[model samples]
Target: MRLIRWLVPVLIWLAGCLVVGRAADGAEVMLPEKFQRLLPLHEPLGKPGPFDWLAHHPEPGQTFGQYVASRPVVPDRRRRTIYVQPLGEFTEAQQRIVELAGRYLRIYFDLPAEVRPAMPLKLIPASARRRHPEWGMEQVLTGYVLEKILWPRLPRDAGAYLAFTPTDLWPGEGWNFVFGQASLRQRVGVWSIYRFGDPDRDDETFRLCLKRTIKTAAHETAHMFSMLHCIQFRCAMNGSNHLAESDRRPLWLCPHCLAKLCWATKADPEKRFRDLAAFCTEQGFDEEAEFFRKSLAAIQGRR
Candidate 1:
């Protein structure tokens, strides 16, 4: 069962690689010079650590040109809004993280982000619920929530419909748990805050939880846009097999991935960096704020 769970993602990734290769024609559009300039700032992915995601599932990396040629999904005028749905209960601190995450998504994607009223966990039937045999913790079926619950409720104007839950999630019988799951074609996704730690514990913990939540929010949403897992750099879109690997990932997209986002959303690179920088500054993410500031400077030809 565990082997099957792992093989599914591997097979999907291999199939995507084939699609990307076949789609790579001379029709690939060139990214702007400003975006090209930032490429050097990012480091190419190195050897995977012992427990890294790459070690388990090697992925053929996608380039900016190939991404364009692949005809990846992008937001259209008809689907301009990004809707965030709250599932189940959340602590006061967790609720704050959700609100902040929504705000970050708005700035990140340059789209209108709305959080609908909370939906009760009671909506998940007993058949879809389980208690971990070893950990003894409650779990819910991620596939059930994503396909049955979120997909049906997806809004007409939603470029992406994301569900933020406070409970733990398992993809199916084999997997123990997953931080999140998404349907790239269906444009719907769900993520759990269960392993992000208690934000209410302390200021530091709150910030940590907020950061994790935001990263997952942005990363998963990118998937909805049909962006594949990044392998070019230490990017937000990089796949992570565990919490530590996820923690090691940057909170910002690298140049290649950024170009895809900019092209898809028609966002101005400089303005996008400035907006992200300002948000990070306001949220007391000094290091991240500094990085965005540098990115903005680079895009403006000042650095």
Candidate 2:
């Protein structure tokens, strides 16, 4: 019994380390082709670069990158509440984000997700904004700080990948300058859609980044439950780096992949997931609403 306890922790820790390393490698999700000009694949904005959350799937029995997307999402006879604990300086932001994320989960993932009232996501603001001429006074987002915000949350090892994203990098009034970098192709690995939000503006990036942020939150959370990139199918799991790539990819997972999603999450495919169009409509994404609606019906009907 003594040996088992000691060994269990050690083994669990070792397992966690491997997953953390894989997350750090990042998944390479593709964005919609039309939005590619705005975002791009090499950047790894919404989807990861090419990294799996567990670095690999935890339960390899059912499938590789696909989780039964909605099966585990069934109504919780018991209350289901998730919380975030932020570390370092910006505790309030982290806590509030957890609440916002819950709102998003219930709406998009169709999960009755809840946020615990007392639990506050810890926040550390050492790397909050950056110093840039275009960004005005306190606007800093100098670089990708996932290592600061997220990676440290890991205890050496945990899941497959570490999804590190800032609020968002949607185009604003001065977006042309922010994204009009000459290094778009050469450094897709290092370069992302965000440089800094407009210096003179207020919270434009925060609001605009909502759509992409939800995509990322849902994607990363799926990783936590042992889901993989839907790349093999023309679905959201496809790796993308730019906005266009994200836009091009449909919100629905493919049938084979959906099967895996069904297995992992145990959600009813017919009921749990909101038809892509419905999801888009709820999100006020009128642009792709019709397209995703059609896609979801076609995909679900066939199966």
Candidate 3:
């Protein structure tokens, strides 16, 4: 099913109010000196357009201090690898995106990531499958996948286990479809590339599909570590209600969210930026590469 899209003009005004005044006040002071340098390079989220995620969700964004206080789930000596499990058959192009997403996740979180062998779609029994009421597309129940498929097969050393499927997903009834879904406490999530557009169409479309896949993968994985939707900046952790909103989000985290990830994974801020910069450059994502390089420069005091 095509994801829903619409615009709600007056709601844009409310997007301004999504950030808690206290969180904004404490944002900078909560992070280390290096992370604070990243503040000026990042922009606050633009006003949400009609039918935007922020306009409808209205989240009171989390701050670095808030995230730390939550005692979030973080990787330990025993379980630190992020595992990506393929749930069904994928086109050569689609498979390429999946593999790249695993590599991106490694740099994005500074975690060890592995792409496992594909699990046949037939593994998902008929009970968990349904044809969308109106859209007529075959959809899998996300809850079933998370609990039955992912949870059971979760590896002993996995910090987070994510199922990458080419199938459509619905969390349950009353919702049409979702781009992806994750379990905050379970450390298991499932996302689909089915709605991300066909990567085989062209070079530009392939890059677009790769970017979108990376965004959702990183965004949902952070949830398992207890990072909430970012309200303070235009960031990867920000809640995306649809493809348009997700596309508007950058591939990097805001300082506050970056601080959270760095702390959770014990990753060095400068090194993380440098790695992402190199990865983007290698992938032909010139704009994203420049942004990563600029962020690294900010932390290194070169800018």
Candidate 4:
């Protein structure tokens, strides 16, 4: 079954492609063509460098049609809230970013989002914690966080349960460290702000940290609904093997991926763009704000 791929332990960080091609299950999904209007406003994906995720892990990209055909997880009236669980202590600035992420998720998905009370790191056992042999940075086990800590506490009303931490994360042996990790079926995911940069730094660095956190948070949450990476355009869903590549990726979803998000979340693309543009403007993301404004205009048939 196609779900077998998702059931297997898979960890997706802020990550993909524009293949409006056949789905693995070969089921067809009728998509609205309105999203096609935004194509002129987007740029195609550039060639990948040797260290980029595409260069190493070439994937058959999923389109809006394929995504819907897959019968992805979607929010329902009973299970419509996104819960942000804090796993460790965070600085005041880091806490602010987490709160903002929750707000952004609420706006981005048109779902209610809540930031839960902080959970002590002491709750994690020694078995699930480790110190990197080479880097000497203490790290948390991503698998343990998902299965052990998050699974048991999964709230009945949660569409997605995401854990935020300040520690580095590692999936398992042989893997060095991960920016974050999420399960496709589990509804639980975790990411660290430790490497996102010190938000306590100056204003520029704070904005940078905020942008990275928001990107990762939104990207990982999307995976919970089975949205794949976009190879079709320069998009928020594109994968990155390293920080540089991720930094280069825009904070906007491509038209194809945007279609998937709107379908999955039952969101209005026009309203989503307006909300995003407003948020970006407030956050001093001038370029992204302008792009979203243009996207809004394009979709509305405004010249």
Candidate 4 lDDT tens digits, 1-303: 678667553423111022324446523443466777888888889788999989998988887777876878888889889999988989888899999999999988888999999999998899999999999999999999999899999999999999999999999999999988888687999999899999998888789999999998899888887888888789999988999998999999988888888888899988989999999999999999999999998888785
Q: Give the TM-score of candidate 2.
A: 0.44
TM-score, per-candidate, Cα-based: 0.90, 0.44, 0.88, 0.89
lDDT of 2: 0.40
**How high is the lDDT of residue 122 in model 2?**
32
Q: For candidate 1, what is the lDDT?
A: 0.88
For candidate 3, write residues 155-247 as lDDT tens digits.
Answer: 999999999999998888798898788887779999989999889999989999999999889998889888899988989998877788889
TM-score of 1: 0.90
Clashing pairs in 4: 16-229, 16-230, 16-238, 16-239, 17-229, 17-230, 17-231, 18-231, 18-232
Clashing pairs in 1: none
Task: Estimate, for each residue in 160-179, the C-alpha lDDT of model 1 and write its tens digit.
Answer: 99999999999997889989
Ranking by TM-score: 1, 4, 3, 2
Residue 260 displacement (Å), model 3: 0.9
Cα misplacement distance, residue 25 of candidate 3 (Å): 13
Best by lDDT: 1
Sequence-dependent TM-score of model 3: 0.88
In model 4, the runs with Cα more than 4 Å from the true position are 1-31
